[model samples]
Target chain A: MTDSPPREPRRLTRGEWLVIAAPAAWIALFFLAPFALIVKISLSRPAQARPPYEPVFDLASGVAGLLEKISQLGFDAYRGLAEDTLYLDSYLSSLTTAGIATLVALVAAYPFALAIARAPQKWRPILIGFAVAPFWTSFLIRVYAWIALLKDEGIINHALMSLGVIDAPLPMFATRGAVIVGIVYSYLPFMLLPLYAAIEGQDPSLREAAADLGASPRQVFLRVTLPLSKRGIVAGVLLVFIPAVGEFVIPDLLGGSDTLMIGRSLWNDFFANRDWPAASAAAVALLALLLVPILLYERAQTREGRR
Target chain B: MSARVLRNATLALGFAFLYGPIAILTAMSFNASRLVTVWGGFSTKWYSALVHDERMLQAATISLSAAALSALIATFNGLLAALALARFGAFRGRSLFAGSLYAPLVLPEVVFGLGLLLVFVALDVERGFVTLVLAHAAFTMCFATVMIHAALKDCDPTLEEAAADLGATPLRAFILVTLPLIAPSVVSAYLLAFTLSLDDFVIASFTTGPGATTLPMRIYSQVRLGVSPEVNAISTLLLGFVALILTASALLTRGRAKGGGAG
Candidate 1:
């Protein structure tokens, strides 16, 4: 690199303080405080009425009691979650569904990201904008479109009947397959966007250098392009997987009773069942599961950012 | 594989998959039939009915105000955070601070929404438009930060230094030099915040008080009631509004950059 000025540390003045304070304070109160609040509620017993958390124990109860109490938070919710087979089943199902959805999305989006990376400069924006088209509409509308298509006598059936492909109209809606389709349809862009950014950032010169050295196209791609884009793959998976894990809308609309995911369970506990503490616990546990990706993504971005 | 063939097929397929359903919905919005998803002929009858729907109209106005207000607050906070992040890297706890802002972006909306609902309840704050706006601004800041940080990381600091050398104060230099150069990201960030707020349902559901419903909440309620072509009409109109904003922005940038050769 190009380095002109000698490196020196400079203290931040009042101006810098002014720049950072507002955003920090806002995030602290609303974002961070609420997470702490949920964690607190998760430790408490279920509330039947308004403000549905009761503290597990006061701090003055002693360090031993507090630690034991904090650890019991999971079991407290788990006991309730297990007793209600629906809640437990949904949690497990959502995890599997989200995992499968992420796998499908990665398979689908990778080649597209590669294509966009190698696209002609002139058509790039047009293609990219098209990639972003789904995001331009309301999320509910997109899911509804799937509903329109996947209903038993919906457009898919209509098209298939006209073509005389099946003797019976296939049952497409309210199935695992339909739910997966909805998840993939909604998250396809999320997978593509990061993968595109990462793949595009990889220098094209490396591929040329590999070719110049008499490497075959497949060898160059497998050995060079794929490895270089692993970071993108990770980022893509994370982006798709985390949200898919907590997906409520698609499952709520398209999924059958068997498609019990954690999100819908959490939704029911609070809204339908009116078990606030258990709901808060399920939600917190979901948040805890999500924290893994959130923390990982933050760490990766920060690490990448420093360079 | 040949890059041209590979790219063409991938681009065409990807675009079709992404945009195809949306196009269908848009077309059906104007379908001159009682069947919502079935095709018959084209007319604007659904759109006309959408305008007359009092509930949807009220929700739209509420959503617009919420989006605009939250976006303004998010932009202000995001710009400053980006500035501090890009310039003042000397501070300890920078990553921690950044993480706090960025956490909401990655945390599931279900979790974040639940957490915020708890916080509001704990604080005994009434959940309504005010609560909705506060929560929206809080989480939307993550998007603003990401957009601006991406822009700032690529920006050359030499421009600011040059401005400073020419007798500009740090504040003046940033206003005159840095802001103008990075304004595209600001617009992009604002656009992102707008969409996130406009599309927010989970958070709004948790925090929005009675009768302070936004469009997504309204639509979700309507969907639970039953699917209707009226939803399609409302969606089509909203889509058109976003498209218009993006088009105007592009044209404005084009005119401003006239023959500037990618400055």
Candidate 2:
């Protein structure tokens, strides 16, 4: 391979150094260091002490004490996570639930994105604004809003009964279905924005040419439009799905006691069970499970950036 | 055409799905009845109740303070990071710096929250207003950086170079020339960070200690206990505040664009 000519490396000035170093150091301390702690803590034992975990790094006790503490750390949490069906079940269900919700949001958001993208130029901004308006509101409150709408005595039930659609109120709240609804509703904007951007960026002439070439509307859509918007679909799906997989709010509020998600399980393990090691282990596993989607999203992002 | 009808129908249904609950919740905030569902008559009693609710009020104060502090810190740091990424031209460890900066955006809140809490514990730092501000700033800085970076990327670099040619230092060139041009985006980024901090629940829940509960934390607890009209009232107020800020921001950016174009 022919190598490119070597160039002189430009030294960073003081202003450049300040700008680059500040955020890097902050993230290194607060973001990267914490992950290391999580991995370390996950290997330790749960305790009845204030911090609620054993094998603390006591700097004052010197090197011997630190090594002793390190030796005491074990895979007990991961072992427990593997042994317990609850952990595995929660992980599986969280993935499935988030997956289903992503599909539902995609199906619902695609048409919305299409409508906005194809709307009159004057109306495009307004339509897009409306799509994202819900995001300005508090997420917890939005999930809470669903509680008022889905509960037995809530608006949906009252309306159904008033219209004589049903004799008794339907059970909606605290169901897996409600959790799905909450996720889809909350994440619709995430799905819509990317899809709209993708669809809107397309050359309309291509679709017109495809139609002129004897392609049916459906055929043009499936072959041209959908394929063209594949990047958006992947971006949107991962954008919604990754967060939904580890979602703590919707499941805790909208899901029944029977509803199992890794997020809620981690919350319960840490807060309710006071098992720091277990929660850390669960978090580690959740991060591991989500690695593929996160990487895919990064790839899509880089591809988009390159364009 | 049937396709047009289908498209419009989907738009309507999608918007309804998105806004219906919010509308209903806002309406219920004015319900006279104590029961959230049954509307006895039009009233602002719940709003009044929210005003007097000590716990909710205290939480709101803390939330606002933390949001302001965190947004300030995040915006400043994000401004630096944006400059680094956009103007520094592939500095050493740039990819690693960018990775950590963006990583928090997709990292599960539960995971980040747990990690931060553990760190605070390990370091023996008290978890309260300070920790909450630190954690919120850490996560929200990425978003601010993204917004400001987009603005910086679109900026013409010659103006800054011109300032430098006029004998201004690089920092002075940035402050005098580049900063004003991107001021709108900086304000927008600040507002975005503010709202994200205010809206955070899970991370705040983990990082906050006694007496540092946020509005979302309070609302979450109350909602878990069951629905209340007071919660509705508070939520409606928050919704109105956020909408107002967002509208002002939109106008600010739009006004700047128009002014720039006219000039």
Q: Write the per-residue lDDT of candidate 2 for residues A14-39, one digit (tens) a residue.
A: 76777777787889878998899899
DockQ of 1: 0.55
Q: Which pairs in model 1 have colliding backbones?
A: A90-A260
Worst 10 residues of 2 chain B by lDDT: B89-98
Candidate 1, A91-132: lDDT as tens digits: 788888999989999999999888887877776666766686
Report the error of model 1 at residue A48, Å: 3.6
Model 1 CA deviation exceeding 4 Å by range: A1-12, A55-75, A203-205, A208-216, B1-6, B162-167, B248-263
List, residue by residue over B1-263, the lDDT tens digit for candidate 1: 57687678877887787877778878888888757546778889888888788988999999999999998899899988888878886565565677677778677777788888887887789989988988898888878887788678767899899989999999899999878877877887787788788988888988889969999988888777555788878888877877776665455444434523456
- Checking candidate 2 for backbone clashes, the offending pairs are none
Question: A278 in model 2: Cα distance from truth in Å?
Answer: 0.9
